[model samples]
Target: MSDAQFVQIVGAVYEHSPWVAERVVSQRPFASAEALRSAMRRAVQQAGEAQQIKLVRAHPELAGTAAARGEMTAASTSEQGGAGLNQLTPEELARLQSLNARYSEKFGFPFVMAVRGHDRQAIFAAMTQRLNNDRDTELRNSLEQIDRVVSFRLNDLISG
Candidate 1:
């Protein structure tokens, strides 16, 4: 795709995911690929509380439940279930489910991650580790990670 088409797709994606709308729209007509990436990182860094919440909500749940409903991307769904969250055997699934339930209940949302290349055990460990964070810090970190994931995905979409 040309730069203009890339801009359009990025803009639409930002709008579709409201969390990134203002940032994506505001940084239109990027002069270089690096500039576009920098803008995205800055957008996430400067995102307000509401935008952050929207971003978190846009991500699939930790156990891949929301993903199966088409609310999340197919690639994310597969990654979450097939690897990062998938290593749990039935017993382990139950244990992780308990942990996930507790974590979400504490945070008011499901645990979110960009699990493109993670294994289930690794994700599980990360989940446990992240649960140690206070709500504010974890929320910020999670959204930043989501923005990174989206940016990478956008680059792929545009390049292809």
Candidate 2:
């Protein structure tokens, strides 16, 4: 397939950061799913700290402003809804908002989680716990979480 078509198919695996896919387009025809996933991860890892942070910042916070205003990408909307983020109680929403603010304040980026099999309480607990982590650790953890999310997205887009 052409590079453009390849990107169109998987560019969104990393939320708004299509550059990850764009970077690896020249290395197409991956031998297996794991190969493709690894290339994508390498793209992010080699993108430098600034771009890595930008990639993490591209993700919408769980049930944050984007979700509230219905502005998140369709994949994000569905993934977050599956975690019951769309059905939060008022108190739950407020608490999450507070946590989001604090986390962003500390880390300079919104908190990110795969959120596929997790519920709101689990997400809350994770946010609270991750708040204690230093910036370097949180950045690494956030990228790892993005990898998990990208893995799920790639699975949904590909078949054996």
TM-score per model over all chains:
0.77, 0.97
What does candidate 2's lDDT look like per residue over 27-139, in tens digits?
A: 97899888999999999999999999999999998899898899999989999999999999999999999999999999999999999999988999999999999999999
Cα lDDT, all candidates: 0.67, 0.93
Pairing residues by index, what is the TM-score of model 2? 0.97
In model 2, what is the error at residue 120, expressed in angstroms?
A: 1.0
TM-score, candidate number 1: 0.77
- Deviation of model 1 at 67, angstroms: 3.3
Residue clash pairs of candidate 2: none
Best by TM-score: 2
Per-residue lDDT of 1-160 in model 1, one digit per residue for the tens? 5545555566443424633544565556779766776777677667777766776766666665654355655556555666646456777777777877877888876677776777777777888898899999888777767765676566766687
Cα deviation in Å at residue 21, candidate 1?
A: 4.1
